[model samples]
Structures are given as C-alpha cells and as structure tokens.
Target: MVRPDGSIRVGTATVAGVLAGTVLAGCGTVGGSPAGKETSSTREQDTKAVRSAYGKTAEQDTARVTLRVQTSADGTSMTASGRGTVDLRDGDSVMTLSAQGGRVEQRVVDQVLYQKLPRSEVPGGKPWIRIDLQKAAERRAVGGQSVNDPVQAAAFARAIDGKDVTREGTSEVGEVNTTHYRVAVDVAELPDGATLRRQLGPTLPMDVWLDGDGRIRRQQIDMTLKAPAEDAATDRASSPPRPAKVRTVMEFSDFGTDVEAKAPPPRQVTDLTGTALERGQTQN
Candidate 1:
C-alpha cells in the first residue's frame, strides 16, 4: 500500500470509516442544552456514573474487538482489519493489524512495556521489518501510542467528563438496548496537533450511544476537513482550501469473558534488495 510520509495511509475503506467515527465522537454536539453550571454538574455526575459502569462491566467481561478501517477521498481507497484483546485488570493487551489481502502487523503489550514484533507480508510469509518490544515500550513512554478501538473508547469517556452532555433517548443496536448521549467537545481540549482534528478540522459534532452499562456501543459523527484547492500547484501545497464533510458510523458487539490471545511465532527477517532466501534460513 502507499505509505504516506512513512505512515500507512489507512485507506478509505470501511475500517477508515470506523476510525473516523471514533475521532469524530470527540467533537461538537447535537441539539443539546447550552453549557452552564447546572449542565456541567449534571454532565460530571453522568460521566462519572458512566465510567463507573464501564469499569464494572469491563471487570465482568472480556472484549474481543474487531476494527474495520476505510479511508477515502478524491478516489483512492484503502481498507484494513484489526483485532484487539485487552485485559483491563493488568492493562495488558495485544493488537494485530492485517490487510485482508495479506500483510500483518502484530503488537504485544503489557502495561508500560510493549513489543512490536514485525510487519509480516502474508500468513507464514517473510518479515519485512522487526521492531523490538523493549524499544517500543520505551518509545511509547516518550510519546508513541498505538491507536486502537479500546484506546478510542477510553478517550471518548474522558472527553465526556465535565462536558455538556445530554441524553438523546434509547435505541436498539444489534438487539441491545442503547442510550444515546450527545456532547459538545472542543478540539482545543485535546493535545495540539492531534491527527484527527488536524486532518478533519476542529469543530464538528458527534452522537454517541451507550449500552445500559454505559459502555459506548455505537457512535455517529460528522466532520469537516479542509482540503487543497483545485487550482493549487501541488496536492500537498494547497492553500486554505474547501472543506470536505464526512459522516461515520460504528458499532461494537460480541462482548465475552476470559479471552486469551496468542502471538504468532516469529518469522525470519529479510532484506528488500531482491535476494531470495535459501530454504533452511527461515526462523520460527
């Protein structure tokens, strides 16, 4: 796939849509009361209650989440599928990212320590690059953080705290009862240069749906991004441009318990200089 600036351009596929949905959930509002002391107090209590419920629910069940990402604009599209396993008690987790066509990236994490094994080209295929887990863990402490659905879920919870939140009623999502909450969040509240707001603009609205336990089960969001002007010289050098509007929707399901995930055996690393490896040179 096309690596833009050394980072994979998560294509405009279903998975990209989901990521966009997660990010958009951190912005704006939907017909909610104006922000005031009463509104703030109620929202604080509600958010605390929600977080408490989430903690309890998480303690009771294990989450095996699958993320589908699709990113598209202009005409190009890219899709990715990933799975995440989180053990809330110890904050240990494992996440694997793979292109449906074959490429696979795996990460094994235990709290502050993590290991990014390698980017395997295909199932049982050659390794293109290997990342030391110890090094990855250190880097994460310095600033690098993996982007996953569970992380996004946590961020959403944080965003709702002490903000202007309003209940939008109940709805059924995949046979589960969900209560919808709308909150207006300012992008400024997030760290500067957050990719979501920088690429998608700063002032959009999000609608979030929570199950009875207050866990976010679904979300709908709208975002407006500034893109290059048609008359710009280069695609990357465009001036303050027209805004592109996007809508995203996401749903989470199949909550279970005591899930155990295992990392695949390590693969032999290879150089990309066109040399074919001898048969017995493979590593387990």
Candidate 2:
C-alpha cells in the first residue's frame, strides 16, 4: 500500500504516516517567533546557516531523536510519538513507539527494515517482519518515493531556497537556546522532488530550530495531501476522499552518541519482501 507521501508501506502497523521505514505520539504545537521578511543578504545568510548546520549534523554521525507525528483525516485525528538513536553514517537506527494503544518497534540497517509485531501475525510466530526498501525502490513501487531514516529526514532542510527562508528570531529546544527559522522546502531540488511535487505540490513549508552550534535541534513539517485530480471535480459522495494531513516533528539531542542497530536473529525474522511485492503488484 502507498503511504500519504507515496512511499510503499512496509508493515501493517504504522504510526501516523511514518514507520514504514521511519516514524510518532505526544505531538503538539510548538511556539516560535513569527515570520518576518528578510533582506536579500539576510536570506542568503540564512540559507548558508541551514546548509552549514546540516553539514555539522552529518559530521556528528549519531544522535538521539524524539519523533512526534500528528495526522488528521475525514474528521478523525491521531497522534503517535517515539524515541530512538540513529547512526547517520551507516544508515542504521533503532526506535520504539507508542501508537494505537500498543507498542511498535522498528530497526533499519543497510536499507532493510525490520518490524517487530504481535506474535499472532507471523507464520511461525516469528516476531519480526523484514522488508527490503531497496528492492521496493527498484521495483518502482506505485507512488514512487524513497524512504528515509530519521537522520536522513533532516536532509530536507538542504532543499531550502534562500528566497523562502525567514529568520524567526530565537527559541529554546529542550535546554538549548536556538534560532528559529521558517523555511520553504523547494521540493524540486530533492532527489525525488519531481515525484514529490506531483504528489505533494511545488513547495512545502517547514519550521527549523538550530542551536548555537548550528546543529538542528528541532524541525517540523506540516503536510496537506492534495486530492486526486480525477476525483476533484466529482461529487464528494461519489469520489473517494483525500488522504490524511500529516505533521511530522523531529527533535535531536546527544549528538555523537553511539548507535548500534543490528539485525534481528534469523529465526525470529520473517522475510516478507516477496509477498509484499506481489501484493503491491496486484493492487497496482
């Protein structure tokens, strides 16, 4: 199945719109300075600051992360939250989340995602389901998008345009004093920007908080899903409704922390890649 963002769904129990590879509860509004116009030079400076911050964050190689995802659709809304550690260089991560009155666990290593689900779902009562995102990507799954781990999700800041960045003054994330900025993500500049633009629209607004060291302390993206064109002009009763509105917030701390994400024991894992791919083909 396709996620709201068009990426292939990996497991049955997803928290909010994430968790297929990356994921949330405890999501709430964050207060910050109101957006203010900036001079051209200031805009350039802001862009440089964000880019440089991204570089510094990458250099740290590992960090502790807290995630909150809020979604609303068809008059229903839900929130999910989680915490985890990520190894930026190796693309490995381990996370545990609270959602739908249950606990969900996920691990990502070397492009493979392992999800630990309830005991009943597995054929042999295996606890973990394995999905190869690389295989899914190679298959050109219908919604066509890349799944990013928490660390890589921050890369979205790299797509910012100088003209769309506004310095929002200061705020504190956790105990760290930070500079808050409102940014417009130039979706076209991302690797999958073309597909995202077709699905999510031209530009996405974002709020980013950076510490004195220029590392991102907090970032949030509130996304509104566009209705399908074919369904747009049809009667609401006849056409399907649009997907949920998803808001994802990520907070980072403990940079340079050690993160070790190893694969689940083979006996406990059920390789679901082939079955998932077949099911996807049938749906498509």
Candidate 3:
C-alpha cells in the first residue's frame, strides 16, 4: 500500500509511481529531566509513567493493525486500507492492502519484504517481488524504517511531556478504562525518526488513550500537509497543488500474541532480479 508519506516499497526500491502514494519514541527522560523515573501520581508523573510503559514492549510483541489513509494530490483522492497482524518484535507482518483498483498481498519476514503483484511483469507470470531491507537501508530505501529494534517504551516522554498536556477524561476502549490525553505532537521535539511528522508535516494533533498499565490502547493523529511530493497525478501544469489531509487511528489489541510469517509458495513467487529490480522505482 502507499505509505502515508505517499510512497511504497516493494523491497528496498521505492514504488512511488506504483501506489497513488504510499505509506515513536518512549517516555523516560524529559527535557533535561531525570533520566529514568516511572511514576503516575501527578500529571508529570503520569506522563513519565506513560513514557515508561511505552518503553516496555518486549513482553508485548504481536498486534493486529488496521490502517486507513486518504491522500489527495493531482486533482485526485485515493483511499487505502490495510488490515493485518504484525510481530512487533521481529517486524514481520502479513497484510493485504487494497488500492489502485485491486488488492495485493505483502509480507515482511526476516528483513525481506515480498509482494505478490496484481499483474505479473515477470516471465511465466511470476507474481512476487522481493526486496531486502538490510541492503535497502544502506541506500535509504522506502522501507528502511522497518528495522524492528526494541524501542524504549516511555521514550516519547522526552518529546511529549513538556508540551501542554490535557487529560480530557476517562474513556472505555473495549473493556479497558483508559485515561485520554490530547496534545500536539511536535516533530521538532522528537529525537527518533519522525515518520508520522514527516508524513503529516509540521506539527499534528494527537489523541491517546492509556490503560492502567500505562500501555497505549489507542492513538489518533490528524493533520493536513502539502503532499510529500509533486502530486503523482499532476500533469505538467503547476497550479497550486492540493493539500492532503490524513487521519490515522491505531488500536492495539492481543498484545504478546503469537505472530508468524512465511514466504509465498515458490510457485507463486517471482524474484525481481537484475533490471526488473532497477526498473519501476519512482523518485518523488
């Protein structure tokens, strides 16, 4: 699927022209604040607890993800969705993404991402394309961010705690009662890769729900930004391009669940070797 940033990665290569587009830190230390404190009594304490809790993801690895995005550029708007399960610990995920008039299956296993294309350009109608993320990362490929390293749960605390935080109230997400907080996600404040910030551009609004365990139950981000690239659909004309507004909600469930990914059957797979791998990579 097109990443929210309006790019797609088939392996290490960017399929920007392929999809209409494409498609967090923990708490801990905050602004010269003490390095490691996990408390939740006061608002500051609560933020620290959250930042810490977010840091503790090793015990919770697998989760189901439902993602939706609407991108407008080039006088056209594209809506896409991905419903899948991911192994956060290993960064392995299998998903079916719907867009561009059809559906394609994508699986990331062992730092290798494989896609079964909607139309096979390979000989014998091979349906799969492979990209090695390890190799791609050195080149800064589209999916380079797929590194599945364990992140400090509360790492975001350093970025968000100092901002004005408002705990709106308590809400029930599923069976869990959660404390809801609304804050602006400042990209400049973040130390890690600003993936969302880069996608939404500038600062964006964020709403988060944290369970008693200080684990994130849900998060929502909404923002509008000039499209990340020249509108893929735009012709030669250069009238003011359309701005794309995106809203994303992530609800995590079944934490620590079992998640396993495997390659497509060999018969159904196609290795995008040599020139085929060099072709179709669109740079925006």
Cα-based lDDT for every prediction: 0.42, 0.63, 0.51
lDDT tens digits, residue span 39-79, model 1: 65676766675545445545545554444445455555455
Sort order, TM-score high to low: 2, 3, 1
Per-residue CA lDDT of model 2 for 1-284, tens digit only, reads: 11222222211112113542023222233553344545678778888887677667768887887766676888897776667887655556777866567676777677676777755445567888777766655553423233223344455656766778777777667877788888887878766677677667888777778888888777677677676555565647675776657776777789888777799999999887786577556533
RMSD of 2: 4.9
Candidate 2's C-alpha runs over 4 A off are 1-17, 20-37, 140-158, 229-240, 279-284
Clashes of each: 15, 5, 23
Q: Report lDDT (Cα) of residue 206, candidate 2.
A: 74
Ranked candidates, highest lDDT first: 2, 3, 1
**Which 10-residue window in model 1 sums to the lowest lDDT?**
4-13
Number of clashes in model 1? 15
C-alpha RMSD by candidate, in order: 9.3, 4.9, 8.0
TM-score of 2: 0.80
